[model samples]
Target: YMLARSTGARIIVEFGTSSGISTLYLAAALRDNGGGRLITTEFEPSKVMRAKANLAEGGLIDLVEVREGDALETLSADLPERIDLLLLDGAKALYPEILSLVESRLRPGALVIADNADFSPEYLERVRSLAGGYMSTPFGDDVELSMRLG
Candidate 1:
């Protein structure tokens, strides 16, 4: 949300909407920006249904697109891949996949915010490997960090 608010991002993409906490923040940011769109994907259909209802309740159905199916697969070349920010809040095992997807899609200086870094070995390694352009937030948990892919 800070990214969107600060940068006035017009296009944002997020993976995983388990409970829709981050989704709400993102949607609100987009709405408050006067114009923006957030496309969120979840593998499970049930989760998508719940997320749609939750987003609607949040008064953000129009600004958000809840896609049901494999998020990685759904992220086609034709879709809005050049994101201002990409949030990865799901499956640790898919960290590499997420990174690859971002690499292909995200624009230079785009931010990739990842979750559950401490618990995921693959994610940690990927972060380590990409240390050239990545750094953790110094203030708090350090779990929520950003990388400027240039």
Candidate 2:
């Protein structure tokens, strides 16, 4: 996250922020970089509130917007065509659907960092197929999957 933020990427979207545990990490990274935004989605309203509270406790409320609703549906309608980083942490069953949505919206140089990817067969295959320049990192592998549109 530090490395990615160092690139000065401005927009980030995250799915499945169940409790904002991961959200904190992303928010901290973005805050460290001086300026950035993290739009995150959670299906459960309660989880959304909890996440918001958690982020607030972590002093990251201003940097993260916790959207409450079906992540896929919300993203399909609202996600911008230009996203710098996308973190997939939603439902395992809906992984494919979200993947397609992300691919359709991702900018050419945008990066997709998936968590629990090892759990999804389709995800592994898709990542393996799409990643052109791959780098093994401490958390997982970073791959240059596509190029952002100008």
Candidate 3:
């Protein structure tokens, strides 16, 4: 969250909103940064409701839009023109497809954080490849952090 704020990130897209734990972090950053938008998706209706409630409780619901549906469908349209940060922590198998959907909108130097990336070897391979258009490396233990270069 601090990293996103430090980089002046105004548009954040998160693939999973499980109870809004991560959403609160991002929303707090947006609040501290004055204002911003967080578009988060969750396919499970129950989780969506819980996340929304959590966001509301955190007083950050105004900064976030919790979309309910498979992210591939929910996040396919109405995205920000320039996405600053992307968090990929949903269905691990769909990380590549999610990235594909948002790749064109990622500004140069955009940051992508994929948690539990080891579950998706293809995603890891794509991001680590020189031809992938991103400079990527493992972060901490299970996270793969990539920066879009193009």
Measured by TM-score, the strongest candidate is: 3
Local distance difference test scores for all models: 0.75, 0.72, 0.94
Put down candidate 1 lDDT per residue, 53-94, tens digits, no spaces: 888898988998777778778765446757888888877778
The candidate 1 region of ten consecutive residues with least summed lDDT is: 131-140
Q: Give the TM-score comparing model 1 with the true structure, all chains together.
A: 0.85
**What are the runs in model 3 whose C-alpha is more than 4 Å off?**
none
In terms of lDDT, which candidate is strongest? 3
Off by over 4 Å in 2: 130-150
Sort all candidates by TM-score, best to worst: 3, 1, 2
Q: How accurate locally is residue 50 in candidate 1, as Cα lDDT from 0 to 100?
A: 82
lDDT of 2 at 133: 30
**Candidate 3 Cα lDDT to native:** 0.94
Clashing pairs in 1: none
Q: Could you tell me the C-alpha RMSD of candidate 1 in Å?
A: 2.2
lDDT of 2 by residue, 112-148 (tens): 6766666666666655553623222225452223233
Q: What TM-score do all the candidates reach, one by one?
A: 0.85, 0.79, 0.98
